[model samples]
Target: MKKILGFAFAIALAFMASGCTMMKMGTAFIKLEPETQEAYAKMMDSIDTYGDPAKAMMIETKINDDVTNDDAVEAIKAITEERNMRVTGDVKMFTKEDAAPDEVKHARIISVCNLTTAKVFLNHSRYYGGFMPCRIMLVEYGNGDRFLITMDLTLAIKGGKPLPPEMLKAALIVKDTMETLIKNGAAGEF
Candidate 1:
C-alpha cells in the first residue's frame, strides 16, 4: 500500500514538471512570428511526403516535358530581370573531363539578389548573409527528368522573432520573387 502511494506521488510530480516545461515552450513559441507555426507545419508535411528533412527545407518544381535546360535557364534570367532582381552569380557545377557519366548531366545554380533588400536584411542581422543571393538550381536527372529548385523561404521569413514591419515586407517580396522565378523557370515562361 505504501509503494502504491509513493508511485502515485512520483507520477504527479512528473506531470507537474512536464507541465511547466510545456508552459515555457509555449511562451517562447508565441513570441515568434505569427506564421511560424504554419511554416513549421508545412515543413513537417514536406518531410512526411519526401522522407527527407533537407527536401522539406526546399521548394522544387519539375520542368515541363517540353522545357529544355537551356530554355529554363533563359527563362529564369528573364524573370529575374522582369522582377527587378539582379543575377549575382551563375555557377555550372560538375563540368570537367573527369565528370562521371552516370552522374547528373546538367546542374546550374543561378543566384539572384536585390541589393537594397539585402542591405536591409544585413543591417538587421548578419545571419541573413548566409541566405544572400537566393539560388535557383536547374538539375537534370539521369532519367531525363529536369527540375528547378530553391530553398523554402517560409522558415527564413517567419522562423524567428517577428521581423520589423519594413523588414518583413522586404522578406515577403523576396520570397514571392523566388517562388515566381522557379515556377516560371520550370515552365520555361518568362
Candidate 2:
C-alpha cells in the first residue's frame, strides 16, 4: 500500500510539472497584452499612412479615383447602410486646413458599428468598448485621391485574447460584415 501511495504522489508531481511547462510556454509568447493602448498603437503603426497594411492587422486599399475626399465618406455611408450597420461618427483630420488647405491633402474617417455585434463583444468584455464603433478612413493625397482603411477584425479580435466560444462567433460575424464593408467601400459599390 505504501508503494502504491508513493507511485500516485510521483504521478501527481509529474502532471503538475507538465502543466507548469505548458503555462510557461504560453506566457513566453505574450509580449504585450492585446487590449492595451500600446498594443493598439503598435497595430495602427503597422499600417502605412497610405492604407497599406504592414505588420499589423489593419487593412488598407488605395483609391484610384480623381474625385474628392467626400467620395470616401459617401462610400462608407452607403456601405454601412447597406450592411445594416450604424454610422457613429465622421471625423475630418487636420481640421486646421485653414493653415493651408491646398498645401496638403484631404483625410477623414467614418465610424460605423452594429449594435448586435457590439453587444456580443461587450458582454464578453466590456473593456472592448474602446474599439467600439469601428472606423473606416478615407484618405486622399489630393482632393480626388482615394484610399480605404479599416481595422482587420480577425487580427483585432485575436489580439484581445482567445475569446469565449460565443464571443468568438460574434467576432467572426463582425469580421465578415466589416470585410464586406471594406470590399464594397474599396470598389465604390454599396
Candidate 3:
C-alpha cells in the first residue's frame, strides 16, 4: 500500500509540473485603447470571412505605411523560417474594408500569415495537442499621416494546455512590435 501511494504521488507531482501556465514571461495582460479594440475586432471578422483558418487562433497585426517593405518582410520571414513554420499560403492583403471611407481617404490593408505546431498521434489517431500561435498584421494609414495599427496574437490550444506566461509574452511582443512600427514609420521607411 505504501509503494502504491508513493507512486501515485510522484505521478501527480509530475503532471502538476508539466501543466500549462508554468512558463515565465512578462506581465499577464496588455491593455489597449477603445479604438484599438474596435479595430482588432473588425480585423478578426475579416480573417474569419476571408482567411477561413481552421483555428484562427492568435492574431497580431500592425497598420503602417509600407511596413511590409523589405526589412519588415524579412523580419517576419525570419521568424517563420527559424520556427519551421509552413506557410499555408502566400501573404494576402486587402486593398480596403467595408467601413473604409468612400473616397479612400487612407491606405488600409490586411495581411494574413499561418503557422502550425507539433501534432500528437496515438495509435493511428492524430490530434492537435500543442500551441499554434496565429498572427495578423493590419496597417492603416490614418489622416495627418498618423498610423493607427495593431497586431492580434491568439494561441490555438488544442489537445494540450498553454503556459500563461508564454502566451502573455507572445502577446506583449506583438503589441510592442506594432508600437515600434508605428513610431518608426514601418521599419523607418518614412
Candidate 4:
C-alpha cells in the first residue's frame, strides 16, 4: 500500500501547490450553489488567455472574443436598464500613453447594481461591499482583438458557506445577472 499512499500524496500536493485553485474552482458546485452554465464556461475556456495563470486561479473569469469595447459598453448599458439595475461606477484603466501605451488597447470597468442584492450582500459582511456592483472589464488589443471579462460572484458571495438564505439568493441572482449581461454583451445582442 506504500505505492498507493505515495500516489495519493502526490495528488494532494499538486492541488495544494496551485494555491487551492482546485478548491476555488469548485466552491459553488461543492456547496451546491448555482454556477455558470456549461456553455458559458466552455466559451470562457476557449478564449485567448492574456493574464497571469497564478492570478487566474484566485478568481472566476469569463472572457469573450468577438465583442468590441464599444459594443460591450452599449450592451451593458441596455442590459442594466432593462434589468432595472443602476450603473454604479465606470473606470478606465491603463490609459497613460507614456507608461505602457500599447500594453492595454482598451480597458474599462463597467459596474452595475441591483440595490436589494447589494443590501443583502452587505448585510452578510459590510466588507463584502468592496466587491459591489457586479463588474465586467471591456478589453481590446492593439492588434484589433476585443474581449469582455466578467467576475463570477458565487465564490466571493456564497462560497464562504453558512451565509444566510437571503444572502445566497442575492448572490446567485447577481451572479446570474452578471453572466447574462456578459454573454449578451459579448454577442453584440440585446
Whole-model lDDT per candidate: 0.88, 0.69, 0.40, 0.68
| Candidate 3 C-alpha lDDT tens digits along 1-190 | 9999999999878876766333422122223232444444655777778795432433333434455444454554455444444333334354443333333333433232222222221112243222223333433332323232433332222112333455445434544543443344345333
Tell me the lDDT of model 3 at 18. 62
TM-score of 4: 0.62
Compared with the true structure, model 1 gives a TM-score of: 0.82
| Cand. 3 Cα-lDDT | 0.40
Residues 1-190 of candidate 1 have per-residue lDDT tens digits of 9999999999878987876667777798889988888889988988898899989999899999998888898999998898889999999885333435466777889999999999999999999999988998888766677789999998998998999999999899999999998899889998
Expressed as tens digits, the lDDT of each residue in 67-178 for candidate 4 is 5566677888898888878898889875533334345666788989999778776776798877776778876656555566776554575343456776666677677778
- TM of each candidate vs. truth: 0.82, 0.63, 0.31, 0.62
Displacement of the residue 106 alpha carbon in candidate 4, Å:
1.4
List pairs with backbone clashes in candidate 4. none
Q: Which candidate is the best by lDDT?
A: 1
* Sliding window of 10 residues with minimal summed lDDT for model 4: 53-62
Q: Could you say which candidate leads in TM-score?
A: 1
What clash count goes with each model?
0, 2, 20, 0
Specify the poorest-scoring 10-residue window by lDDT in model 3.
115-124
lDDT of 2 at 173: 74
Worst 10 residues of 1 by lDDT: 94-103
Q: Report the C-alpha displacement of residue 59, candidate 1, in angstroms.
A: 0.5
lDDT of 2 at 86: 92
The TM-score obtained by model 2 is: 0.63
